[model samples]
Target: MKLETLDALLAARAAKRAVALVTALDGHSEWVVEPGAPPSGLPADLLEAVRQALASDRSGVVEHDGRDWFVQAHNPPLRMLIVGAVHITQALAPMAAMAGYEVTVIDPRRGFAAAERFPGVRVDGDWPDEALERLVPDARTAVVTLTHDPKLDDPALHVALRSEAFYIGCLGSRRTHAARLDRLRNAGFDDADCARLHGPAGLDLGARSPAEIAVSVLAETVRALRRPEG
Candidate 1:
């Protein structure tokens, strides 16, 4: 690896950009495949392999055209952006952090987003929508709204739906979710877009306590992330 390429890789990681470093196993020649800019010199079959490697978020050697190739996916850090600093968030954030995510709790309330409530988690004091816009959810990010308040959840949902966040879950009942879907439809979102919301949020775990609900949501999020039903 040249110093220049190493610098570029470091910069990409810092900017949270998705990139792949490909090395020819035979000659040790290397190339960088950015999200939108794949190497034109690569064969069509080789490029497709690269795409699969990136999607799988795995790094390994691939035998293509009788030549071994090492493809390493350099993805951004996994993140969980929890909306509304509620009791569920208090439980979920810590769990997400333990699961190797960089968790951020977003809410406008000063007391709720206080340091004591979220000891190690990053707490965003900005309004949900504004904060989400700046955060710019990507494929490596997951957004969840725990606040039942439409004022907070709706705005954040609007912003998240417009982004490429991998997962979007909302904590609510089925009836509440139906009403929320109606509101989103009225806001000009189509059925396909509204369908993206995992309303009634978690899995069918029959959770009762806040901690239990958080566990369920986390499980659902992991499912969508690892084994996306899409």
Candidate 2:
């Protein structure tokens, strides 16, 4: 990689954006492609390869035009935004961070959102709606709302539903989820928007404890992220 391209890749990593360094194995030619944009000064055929590499989050060599081309993906770190500083969050935040998610816990309740409780994690003691607006859920983000309170979780749901966030979950029972769906409908969300919510969040592993429930939720998230979309 050229110094200029290395700088660009480093800058993308700093900004938490996806980029890739592609090398033509035979000729030692190179290119950098970031998410949503193709690199300039590269042949058009390699653009498809770069796109594929970034999507799979993999670094590999592919055969192109009778030559081997290597595409090494440099993606932004994965993030999990949990909108509730409750017991479940206490369990989930650490679990998420352990699994490579840059976790952020948000709750307006200062006591619940206290840093001392979370220790070294990002705690945003802001209202859910406003906090999500600033946080800006993106494709690499997974959002989970554990508050169950309509005032808190609903606003965050609104933001997550509209974003490119890969996962959007809310903690509640079937009945509660039905009520929540009605509220979202009344709030102007279409069927498509409502379809995104993984209400009763997590795989049904009969999780009773907070830690177990967090495990199920994280498992579901990982499943959704890694598996092919239906």
Candidate 3:
């Protein structure tokens, strides 16, 4: 109708808030409503048609005459969990943050697990098992263990393998990983569960320094998260 009304409608759509536009099409005016919004200026039967259009996964463009109305869907945020507060993690946290992960560092040692070390990263100075018990891991969560300690890493790894976490990796040598696998097998973890562990964690990039190792770990983490079924 008016320029200001069109501007407001566009602004609301861009902001991803629910809004509707009524325009004349085929000699009749129709209301184009977002999902969960009531229809206006259109026949009752056409309400279901509008709902189907809004529910579609594809980006929407409702055309009436020479005018077009757009509706956008909002995406959820990403979350990542680091199972250690070691040197590699110091580097990993910042890298994960840059890559849009809501990074969290979990450890029992308060001295090594301070927010000061991680800056903007969320630091949880608690035993991994206990902390994870309180905060259940979800499908969106990515778990990485950098502490070479079995006592700390084992409990966390066990919990992570059982959960729906997209990634579960542990830092160690190949020999160490083999031993870890043996231990997990003894602890009732089947081949399927053992398969989930990315031991000697990080890509096969021959990373030596903690920073380089962090990069490799993050790379592997991304790959694993993107391909959960693999």
TM per candidate comes to 0.86, 0.90, 0.70
* RMSD each, Å: 2.5, 2.1, 6.9
* Least well predicted 10-residue stretch by lDDT in candidate 1: 42-51
On residues 119-187, what C-alpha lDDT tens digit does candidate 2 reach at each position? Answer: 879999989889889989888899999998999999899889989999999999999999999999999
- Report every candidate's CA lDDT: 0.89, 0.90, 0.76
Write the number of the candidate with greater lDDT, choosing between 1 and 3: 1
lDDT, candidate 1, residue 229?
71
Which consecutive 10 residues in model 3 have the weakest lDDT in total?
68-77
Give the lDDT of residue 162 in candidate 2. 82
Q: Write the per-residue lDDT of candidate 1 for residues 84-170, one digit (tens) a residue.
A: 999999899999998878999999987889989889889999999999999989988899999999999999999999999889999
User: What is the TM-score of candidate 2?
Assistant: 0.90
Q: Once superposed on the true structure, which residue ranges of model 3 sit more than 4 Å away at CA?
A: 1-75, 227-230
- How many angstroms is residue 187 displaced in model 1 relative to the true structure, after the best TM-score fit? 1.8
The TM-score that candidate 3 achieves is: 0.70
The CA lDDT at 47 in model 1 is: 71
Clashes of each: 0, 0, 0
Better lDDT candidate (2, 3):
2
